[model samples]
Target: MNIRPIEINDYSRWFDLWQAYLAFYTVELSDEVTQKVWERLMNEDDKDLYGLVCEDEDHVIGFTHYFFHGTTWFDSSYCYLEDLFVEQSVRARGAGRALINGVKEQAQTHGAAKLYWHTDKQNETAQGLYNKVADLTDFIRYDIALKP
Candidate 1:
C-alpha cells in the first residue's frame, strides 16, 4: 500500500470511502457540507485542514482527513484526526495503520504538540486499531448541536 497526500484527482475514490465511513457510523451529511470539506482539503492556502489517501495497485483504498488547531493548554497546535476510512474489502490489511502513520508524519512535520482522534464507543474493531496506535484517554466527549 502507498500512502500519500490527497490530490484533486482522487476525489471519486475518496468520496466512496468517505461515504462508507459515514455509513459505518450511521450518519448522513449534506452534499454542501461534503463539498466544502473537499474544498478545504484541496485548498493549498488553507494550512489547517489536510487529507491523505492510501492506494493499492494504483487504486485508492482508504482515506483520512485531519486538521491542526490551537489549544489553550498547549503552545503548539494539536492535530485532530477527524475522519478515517478504508474500503470494507481492504480493512485489515494495514491500510488503516499506514493512513494513520501518514497523518502522524505530517503532524510531526508541522510541529504539532499532540495528535488525537475519537471513535464511537461500540466500534470495537476500530478500537482495536486505536489501542495499538495510541493511548486511550479516560476523558468523555460532549457535544451541543446549535440550530442553524
Candidate 2:
C-alpha cells in the first residue's frame, strides 16, 4: 500500500469517508463542520497537520489523519493520530497498519519522542490492532468547548 499526504483532489470521496467516520463515532456534526475540517486538512500555514492515504491502483481503501503537537512532556514533539479508518470491506487487510506505520516513520524522521492517540472504549476491533502496536496511556482525556 502507498501512503501519502492528502490533496484537495481527494476532497469528494475523502469527505464521504470522513462523514462515515463521524457517524461511527456518533458525532452529529453538520456538513459545514466537515468542510471546515477539510480546510484545516489543507491549510497551507499548518503543514504539520497531515493525513495518510492507503491506495492501490484506483481505490482508496483507508486514511489516517494526524498532527504534530508540542508537549512539555517531551523535548521533541508528539504525533497525534487523530483519525484512522479502513473501509468496512477492507478491515484487517493491513490498510490501517500501513497508515500507522507511515505516521510512525514520519514521527521518527522528525525526531518525535512518541506517537499517540485515543480510541473509544467500545472499539474492540481497533483495540485489537492498537494492542499490537501501542500501549494505552494511563491518563484520561477531558475537553470543554469554548462558547459565548
Each candidate structure's TM-score, on Cα atoms with residue i matched to residue i, is: 0.96, 0.91
Question: What residue runs in model 1 are displaced by over 4 Å at the alpha carbon?
Answer: none
Q: Could you tell me the lDDT of residue 42 within candidate 1?
A: 90
What's every prediction's RMSD, in angstroms?
1.0, 1.6
What's the count of clashing pairs in each model shown? 0, 0
The lowest-lDDT stretch of 10 consecutive residues in candidate 1 is: 40-49
The TM-score leader among the candidates is: 1
Off by over 4 Å in 2: none
lDDT of 1 by residue, 1-148 (tens): 9999999999998888888888998999999988988899899985568999999999999999999999898789999999999999978999999999999999999999999999988999999999999999989999999988
lDDT of 2: 0.85
Over the stretch 9-119, how does candidate 2's per-residue lDDT look in tens digits?
A: 888778778878888998888678777778888998967578878886667877888888889997999888999988888789888888999999988988899999999
Top-scoring candidate (lDDT):
1
